[model samples]
Target: MKIYHNQLTKTLAQGFIPVWLVFGDEPWQKDNSLSTIKAAAQQQGFSELIRFNTESGFDWQQLMDEYQSMSLFASQRIIEVEFSTTKVGDAGNKALVALAERLSEDIQHKHYANDVIFIFHGDKLDGPSANKKWFKLFSQIGCYLPLYDVELKSMSHWINQQCQTLNLNLAPELTQLLIELFEGNLLALAQELQKLSLLFNQSLITLEQAEQLVIKQAKFNPFQVVDSLLLGDCGKCIAMLDQLQQEGIAPAKIIWALHKEISQLYNMLNQLEQGESINQLYKQYRIWDKRKPLYQHALTHIKLPDVKQAMIRIADIDLLSKTSSEFNVFILLADLCITLYHGDKTQALSLKYG
Candidate 1:
């Protein structure tokens, strides 16, 4: 039977099926689901693992050979096949259908049903591929799970679910902050959640604590720094800069980040002035829905001329960092943050040395 990705855990808790078909483009969900299946299989004493990857001109006969052969080492075994393409030709299709049929018969007759666990993994299956005879047989005898990408609107809900799984209680605002920070990247978000579980040890995490501990150590990407700056969180902006610097992140990376954000903001402001909707601009620029408010916040404090000037100054900084021997890129970055935070000004701000 077909199963939703979220339902896999509960389904596994109840029992293990003889065959499983897992396919998707979402790496984290796919990986997590596969891990869950493996864990459940291991608990049920499915110890022997036989793995195969279908490459160019792979012999389908090997799959048949392995399936028909009984293991001398273990009573139960997991047979995993990784498909390069879902279109396994006529011979492969027949082989898979036969295997599924045999497993189904074993289940009905109460013989050899507990001997082998068959798992198939590949890219997301299209409707035509999923509707194939072999796939239908597999689904009837087992579970077919397709991992879909989480949309921006539901990202917060997903994160909250993850936090609960990790036993990390987060305030609503903290959840929103995480949504803004991770955006469309679920793998990174999962890793961060793992780290949070270790650091907080199931303690309820407040917004201030999350900002201080979680965001700082979560590998504050350049985009996150820009978000802080745009939101006019001077403390966060400066703190992120320091964290990035101490982590040995290259100055060139920071410079490139500033240049990219300033350029995007400059273009976006000009388009907004031309009577375009924020939603349209977001689509045009490929901005995440969660970040719309931050962009809007930025536009309110930062004028067109300010972004224009910041872009020009960023170019100058880049040139100096590349060519000048005395150029201090970090100091320039700090100055730029101050400029971004306080808005554009005529006189150059005095650089304070730490």
Candidate 2:
């Protein structure tokens, strides 16, 4: 029923299923999984991939008719039903529920014809227990693949897999850099990959080739900006802040990210006091590899109490940024930065943990 991307790929490669449900919060995983499903479906003589949109006032009868009516040209067809968060509660939900119930009903004998295969795509579903009835039924008959974001360290491996799929040579280090610069977002990365696949004639992707791509294709990803801040690079932090301001990433999200990282750093330091090595601790906490240096510096320069104070100060700042009649976002952020730069140990030691 619920399977990882790799497992799903292996199963799908063997043959097509009656249905496939590819949905997740991780964009890259979801897209890549669906792409594999499509590829596998194509190999199984599912030439026609019909996409149905419920948002454009879809005729429910017409869709049912299409599903009922077998393809004259082909023995099997892949019907893609795309349902976003918006349409999920309305026409799309009703249609899918109806379809599921329709297919579940037993015919005159034990046989139920399923010539039309379905692939349902939407936002990441939480869990099978929390999902709707239609979702549960899909798992009974087909595969439910859940995808998560690829880590920075595993980018090279991901690139190798991508190259293998596209049947091209993608440089390892270059792929790693691309993942670093474009981590957390897939739509942007995918577009860049498409460009590279078209432009690069060499079967083997070199680091040099990837470096140019990263510079040109790298837009101001919020995640990269957050990574810089976590590393405590004020120069870069300020530069990214300025770039984000210029590019219009909401200051609220930036504040939230900074606030989260500060808390995490504080927690990491707290754990170190309990006899955790920095190297082991970082990996244990699932800390991003790019954040290692920043945290290393933070632990060396900061004490537990100081971090606690900074966290409290930022919490207050977050509250004020939302409530104060004369709210000053700049002031809040600057204050947080000041504490980060020069907060004292004595006051921090006196503070209580949340």
Candidate 3:
């Protein structure tokens, strides 16, 4: 049966399934869903769980061998297969195609005596690629649940649900602000909830607790560095860059992150200008998570036009590093901070990349 993630509790209450396919791009949901299902399966007698990564050099026949094997000293077994984007090639296709063609016989029949539960998970499936025959087969024959990532527009609703799960009360305005502050970090967001829930003990989670607990500790993901720089907080931005370099985070990886943030910020500011309500705006624009701050901080800047221009220069620098022989990503990152800080003379861009 094709099931949406929201129906998870219902599905588990109903009992076990021989096959479950947890496919999605949402890491938070994916992790939670799989854990719930796996827990239920284990409690119901599924033991000796076998885990496989798509990147591993295991062949198609080896996959089948594991699937067909009986559990040693256990009543039932769970086999989990994680399919990455790297699995899109010839070998991956072969593995998937083989499983799709034969699993019906193995799972439906009782030849092995020991019950076997199979779980196939994929995070990188999207667009035309998700419609493939092998993938379609899993959903068609058994339990198929897909979890989409949280977008800014849906973040409030999601956060509200998350709060409700923790029995925390929150004002609508405060909820929106919390989502803005936490952005796309559901795991971190959940962590913040637990931290507050212990203190509040099911009482309402106020905006104040969120600020001190969530906002204060949230290490600015390097994703926000460019926007932080563009907003003229050079000191914090540069300090962040230096910290990242010191931590051994690759310069190229940092640039790519900044590039994504700049492009996202440019769009977010444009949407904010069209009189979009905080709720309506997040939905209409795809800004979520770290990108939320780009617009938040941009509001404190001169204008969107200046931010866009600064982003263009950042983009040019990125292209140069990738295509040109000289790949001084460090210098390009520094220049990015300098441009964003000076682009708007209204506020002083602190040159600290901490």
Candidate with maximal lDDT: 1
Mark the regions of model 3 whose C-alpha exceeds 4 Å error after superposition: 84-88, 106-114, 126-129, 171-173, 216-354
Expressed as tens digits, the lDDT of each residue in 1-354 for candidate 1 is 888888998998877698899999887898998889988998999999999988888887787788789898898999999999998888888888887787778788887657788889999998889989889988998999998777657888888888778898877898888876665468888988888788888788788887875553334657667778888786777777776777788778888877888888888889889998888988998888777888889887787876766776777778877887575677677667666645445325533232
TM-score of 2: 0.65
- State each model's CA lDDT, in order: 0.80, 0.67, 0.69
lDDT of 3 by residue, 1-354 (tens): 888877987988886676788877666788899999989988888877888877656665667888766557776888898875523666667767677667765556744343778888887557666677777766665688878656657878887787778888776767777675566467777777777777787776667765665552223456557556655677767766765665567667877777776666666667667765655665666657765665556555636766666677676666776777555566557667666546655224422322
Alpha carbon lDDT at 112, candidate 3: 39
The pairs that clash in candidate 1 are none
Pick by lDDT: 1 or 3, better one: 1
Candidate with top TM-score is 2
The estimated TM-scores of all candidates read 0.59, 0.65, 0.62
| Per-residue lDDT of model 2, residues 155-208, tens digit only | 667666666666666766677677766655566777677667778754677887
Scored against the true structure, residue 76 in model 3 reaches a CA lDDT of 82
